[model samples]
Target: MATSTFRVNVLLKEGVLDVQGKAIESSLPELGVSSISNVRVGKLIEFSFDHEGSSLTDEEQTKLTKVCHELFSNPVIESYTLTEVK
Candidate 1:
Protein backbone atom coordinates (compact mmCIF):
# COMPACT_ATOMS: atom_id res chain seq x y z
CA MET A 1 0.00 0.00 0.00
CA ALA A 2 1.05 3.53 -0.70
CA THR A 3 0.30 6.62 1.32
CA SER A 4 -1.41 9.36 -0.61
CA THR A 5 -2.12 12.89 0.49
CA PHE A 6 -5.34 14.75 -0.18
CA ARG A 7 -6.79 18.14 0.54
CA VAL A 8 -10.33 19.13 1.34
CA ASN A 9 -11.22 22.71 0.58
CA VAL A 10 -14.28 23.88 2.42
CA LEU A 11 -15.92 27.18 1.69
CA LEU A 12 -19.17 28.94 2.30
CA LYS A 13 -21.63 28.63 -0.54
CA GLU A 14 -22.40 31.59 -2.70
CA GLY A 15 -25.20 33.70 -1.19
CA VAL A 16 -24.20 32.60 2.26
CA LEU A 17 -22.91 35.32 4.51
CA ASP A 18 -19.25 35.02 5.52
CA VAL A 19 -18.88 37.23 8.56
CA GLN A 20 -15.21 36.60 9.14
CA GLY A 21 -14.45 37.11 5.47
CA LYS A 22 -16.34 40.35 5.48
CA ALA A 23 -14.54 41.55 8.59
CA ILE A 24 -11.16 40.88 7.02
CA GLU A 25 -12.16 42.44 3.73
CA SER A 26 -13.38 45.57 5.43
CA SER A 27 -10.18 45.91 7.39
CA LEU A 28 -7.95 45.40 4.36
CA PRO A 29 -8.52 48.90 3.10
CA GLU A 30 -7.13 50.42 6.24
CA LEU A 31 -4.12 48.17 5.89
CA GLY A 32 -3.53 49.46 2.35
CA VAL A 33 -5.00 46.45 0.53
CA SER A 34 -7.79 48.29 -1.23
CA SER A 35 -7.72 46.62 -4.60
CA ILE A 36 -8.91 43.24 -3.43
CA SER A 37 -12.59 42.52 -3.05
CA ASN A 38 -15.10 39.70 -2.66
CA VAL A 39 -13.01 38.06 -0.05
CA ARG A 40 -14.30 34.82 1.48
CA VAL A 41 -12.85 32.69 4.22
CA GLY A 42 -12.45 28.97 3.89
CA LYS A 43 -10.57 26.08 5.47
CA LEU A 44 -8.11 23.60 4.02
CA ILE A 45 -7.98 20.14 5.51
CA GLU A 46 -5.13 17.80 4.60
CA PHE A 47 -5.33 14.09 5.16
CA SER A 48 -3.44 10.95 4.31
CA PHE A 49 -4.83 7.66 3.10
CA ASP A 50 -3.22 4.30 2.60
CA HIS A 51 -4.45 2.63 -0.55
CA GLU A 52 -3.35 0.21 -3.26
CA GLY A 53 -2.29 2.60 -5.97
CA SER A 54 -0.80 6.01 -6.68
CA SER A 55 -4.26 7.51 -7.19
CA LEU A 56 -7.34 7.18 -5.06
CA THR A 57 -9.82 4.52 -5.97
CA ASP A 58 -13.53 5.18 -6.39
CA GLU A 59 -14.34 3.68 -3.04
CA GLU A 60 -11.67 5.75 -1.35
CA GLN A 61 -13.00 8.91 -2.94
CA THR A 62 -16.50 8.08 -1.74
CA LYS A 63 -15.22 7.56 1.75
CA LEU A 64 -13.39 10.84 1.73
CA THR A 65 -16.44 12.63 0.36
CA LYS A 66 -18.55 11.18 3.08
CA VAL A 67 -16.06 12.29 5.68
CA CYS A 68 -15.98 15.75 4.21
CA HIS A 69 -19.75 16.01 4.26
CA GLU A 70 -20.26 14.48 7.66
CA LEU A 71 -17.26 15.78 9.56
CA PHE A 72 -15.31 18.56 7.89
CA SER A 73 -17.99 20.83 6.49
CA ASN A 74 -21.58 21.89 6.98
CA PRO A 75 -23.92 20.77 4.21
CA VAL A 76 -26.28 23.74 4.26
CA ILE A 77 -23.76 26.55 4.21
CA GLU A 78 -20.57 25.05 2.90
CA SER A 79 -19.32 23.28 -0.22
CA TYR A 80 -16.16 21.26 -0.58
CA THR A 81 -13.72 20.08 -3.19
CA LEU A 82 -11.33 17.17 -2.85
CA THR A 83 -8.00 17.00 -4.61
CA GLU A 84 -4.98 14.72 -4.56
CA VAL A 85 -1.92 16.50 -3.29
CA LYS A 86 1.39 16.01 -4.99
Candidate 2:
Protein backbone atom coordinates (compact mmCIF):
# COMPACT_ATOMS: atom_id res chain seq x y z
CA MET A 1 0.00 0.00 0.00
CA ALA A 2 1.12 3.52 -0.74
CA THR A 3 1.87 5.80 2.19
CA SER A 4 2.53 9.49 2.71
CA THR A 5 3.33 12.01 5.40
CA PHE A 6 2.13 15.47 6.28
CA ARG A 7 3.01 17.98 8.94
CA VAL A 8 1.36 20.63 11.03
CA ASN A 9 3.47 23.49 12.32
CA VAL A 10 1.88 24.82 15.48
CA LEU A 11 2.94 28.11 16.92
CA LEU A 12 1.81 30.87 19.19
CA LYS A 13 0.39 33.96 17.59
CA GLU A 14 2.36 37.18 17.53
CA GLY A 15 2.06 39.59 20.50
CA VAL A 16 1.20 36.66 22.76
CA LEU A 17 3.71 36.37 25.56
CA ASP A 18 5.71 33.18 25.12
CA VAL A 19 7.06 32.51 28.59
CA GLN A 20 9.08 29.49 27.65
CA GLY A 21 10.59 31.18 24.61
CA LYS A 22 11.43 34.26 26.66
CA ALA A 23 13.07 32.23 29.38
CA ILE A 24 15.24 30.42 26.89
CA GLU A 25 16.20 33.64 25.19
CA SER A 26 17.12 35.33 28.47
CA SER A 27 19.08 32.29 29.61
CA LEU A 28 21.09 32.09 26.41
CA PRO A 29 23.27 35.04 27.39
CA GLU A 30 24.07 33.36 30.66
CA LEU A 31 25.12 30.28 28.71
CA GLY A 32 27.27 32.45 26.43
CA VAL A 33 25.14 31.91 23.31
CA SER A 34 24.59 35.33 21.83
CA SER A 35 23.04 36.91 18.74
CA ILE A 36 19.97 34.71 18.97
CA SER A 37 17.00 37.03 18.97
CA ASN A 38 13.33 36.36 18.44
CA VAL A 39 13.78 32.90 19.82
CA ARG A 40 10.25 31.59 19.61
CA VAL A 41 9.48 27.90 19.93
CA GLY A 42 6.96 25.86 18.02
CA LYS A 43 5.92 22.24 17.48
CA LEU A 44 5.90 20.03 14.41
CA ILE A 45 3.40 17.22 14.22
CA GLU A 46 3.56 14.64 11.41
CA PHE A 47 0.75 12.42 10.26
CA SER A 48 1.21 9.26 8.24
CA PHE A 49 -1.54 8.05 6.00
CA ASP A 50 -1.99 5.03 3.76
CA HIS A 51 -2.49 7.20 0.74
CA GLU A 52 -0.29 8.43 -2.07
CA GLY A 53 0.86 12.02 -2.49
CA SER A 54 -1.87 14.65 -2.35
CA SER A 55 -4.47 12.11 -3.30
CA LEU A 56 -6.56 13.07 -0.33
CA THR A 57 -9.50 15.11 -1.52
CA ASP A 58 -10.11 18.71 -0.61
CA GLU A 59 -12.83 17.68 1.81
CA GLU A 60 -10.45 15.33 3.52
CA GLN A 61 -7.83 18.00 3.79
CA THR A 62 -10.40 20.38 5.19
CA LYS A 63 -11.45 17.87 7.82
CA LEU A 64 -7.85 17.18 8.77
CA THR A 65 -7.19 20.91 9.08
CA LYS A 66 -10.22 21.19 11.30
CA VAL A 67 -8.85 18.39 13.44
CA CYS A 68 -5.53 20.19 13.69
CA HIS A 69 -7.26 23.37 14.82
CA GLU A 70 -9.63 21.68 17.26
CA LEU A 71 -7.61 18.83 18.67
CA PHE A 72 -3.98 19.86 18.25
CA SER A 73 -3.95 23.63 18.68
CA ASN A 74 -5.35 26.14 21.14
CA PRO A 75 -7.38 28.45 18.97
CA VAL A 76 -7.26 31.25 21.51
CA ILE A 77 -3.49 31.80 21.34
CA GLU A 78 -2.13 29.41 18.72
CA SER A 79 -2.24 29.00 14.95
CA TYR A 80 -1.01 26.25 12.64
CA THR A 81 0.14 25.62 9.08
CA LEU A 82 -0.46 22.37 7.29
CA THR A 83 1.83 20.94 4.62
CA GLU A 84 1.83 17.70 2.72
CA VAL A 85 5.27 16.23 3.10
CA LYS A 86 6.89 14.66 0.11
Candidate 3:
Protein backbone atom coordinates (compact mmCIF):
# COMPACT_ATOMS: atom_id res chain seq x y z
CA MET A 1 0.00 0.00 0.00
CA ALA A 2 1.07 3.51 -0.77
CA THR A 3 0.40 6.45 1.53
CA SER A 4 -0.60 9.78 0.04
CA THR A 5 -1.06 13.15 1.67
CA PHE A 6 -3.83 15.52 0.71
CA ARG A 7 -4.89 19.01 1.61
CA VAL A 8 -8.36 20.45 1.83
CA ASN A 9 -9.23 24.12 1.84
CA VAL A 10 -12.67 25.00 3.13
CA LEU A 11 -13.98 28.48 2.62
CA LEU A 12 -17.22 30.31 2.73
CA LYS A 13 -18.62 31.20 -0.66
CA GLU A 14 -18.38 34.76 -1.88
CA GLY A 15 -21.03 37.01 -0.31
CA VAL A 16 -21.73 34.40 2.32
CA LEU A 17 -20.87 36.83 5.10
CA ASP A 18 -18.08 35.39 7.19
CA VAL A 19 -18.83 36.74 10.65
CA GLN A 20 -15.50 35.70 12.15
CA GLY A 21 -13.62 37.09 9.20
CA LYS A 22 -15.54 40.33 9.42
CA ALA A 23 -14.84 40.73 13.11
CA ILE A 24 -11.12 40.17 12.63
CA GLU A 25 -11.02 42.54 9.71
CA SER A 26 -12.81 45.20 11.68
CA SER A 27 -10.27 44.89 14.47
CA LEU A 28 -7.28 45.29 12.18
CA PRO A 29 -7.46 49.08 12.22
CA GLU A 30 -7.41 49.14 16.01
CA LEU A 31 -4.31 46.98 15.87
CA GLY A 32 -2.62 49.79 13.87
CA VAL A 33 -2.84 47.87 10.64
CA SER A 34 -4.41 49.64 7.73
CA SER A 35 -4.40 49.29 3.94
CA ILE A 36 -5.82 45.82 4.16
CA SER A 37 -9.27 44.97 2.96
CA ASN A 38 -11.57 42.08 2.21
CA VAL A 39 -10.19 39.65 4.70
CA ARG A 40 -11.39 36.06 4.68
CA VAL A 41 -11.14 33.28 7.23
CA GLY A 42 -11.03 29.69 6.10
CA LYS A 43 -9.88 26.28 7.23
CA LEU A 44 -7.06 24.03 6.07
CA ILE A 45 -7.22 20.30 6.69
CA GLU A 46 -4.51 17.76 5.98
CA PHE A 47 -5.16 14.06 5.77
CA SER A 48 -3.73 10.93 4.24
CA PHE A 49 -4.89 7.82 2.47
CA ASP A 50 -3.47 4.36 2.14
CA HIS A 51 -4.23 2.70 -1.12
CA GLU A 52 -3.46 -0.83 -2.13
CA GLY A 53 -0.81 -0.37 -4.79
CA SER A 54 -3.00 1.94 -6.82
CA SER A 55 -2.97 5.62 -7.49
CA LEU A 56 -5.95 7.76 -6.63
CA THR A 57 -8.61 7.61 -9.32
CA ASP A 58 -11.70 9.64 -10.14
CA GLU A 59 -13.81 7.46 -7.90
CA GLU A 60 -11.55 8.21 -4.98
CA GLN A 61 -11.76 11.89 -5.79
CA THR A 62 -15.52 11.70 -5.71
CA LYS A 63 -15.43 9.97 -2.36
CA LEU A 64 -13.16 12.66 -1.03
CA THR A 65 -15.53 15.33 -2.27
CA LYS A 66 -18.38 13.60 -0.56
CA VAL A 67 -16.44 13.46 2.68
CA CYS A 68 -15.68 17.15 2.38
CA HIS A 69 -19.30 18.01 1.86
CA GLU A 70 -20.57 15.67 4.51
CA LEU A 71 -18.04 16.32 7.25
CA PHE A 72 -15.70 19.24 6.69
CA SER A 73 -17.84 21.94 5.08
CA ASN A 74 -21.27 23.43 5.21
CA PRO A 75 -22.65 22.81 1.75
CA VAL A 76 -25.18 25.63 1.98
CA ILE A 77 -22.65 28.42 2.46
CA GLU A 78 -19.15 26.99 2.08
CA SER A 79 -17.18 25.28 -0.65
CA TYR A 80 -13.95 23.34 -0.68
CA THR A 81 -11.02 22.43 -2.87
CA LEU A 82 -8.86 19.33 -2.59
CA THR A 83 -5.27 18.79 -3.63
CA GLU A 84 -2.80 15.96 -3.41
CA VAL A 85 0.52 17.26 -2.16
CA LYS A 86 3.92 16.03 -3.17
Candidate with the greatest lDDT versus the true structure: 1
In candidate 3, stretches whose alpha carbon ends up further than 4 angstroms from where it belongs are none
| Model 3: colliding residue pairs | none
Worst 10 residues of 3 by lDDT: 50-59
Q: Show the lowest summed lDDT stretch of 10 residues, model 1.
A: 47-56
Candidate achieving higher TM-score, 1 or 3: 1
lDDT of 3 at 21: 89
Counted clashes in each candidate structure: 0, 0, 0
Worst 10 residues of 2 by lDDT: 48-57
TM-score for every candidate vs. truth?
Answer: 0.91, 0.85, 0.88
Residue pairs with colliding backbones in model 1 are none
lDDT at 69, model 2? 82
Ranking by TM-score: 1, 3, 2
Residue-level lDDT tens digits of model 3 in 1-86: 78899899999999898998889888998989998888889999999877666687787767888889999899899989988889
Off by over 4 Å in 1: none
Q: Which residue pairs collide in model 2, if any?
A: none
Per-candidate local distance difference test: 0.91, 0.84, 0.88
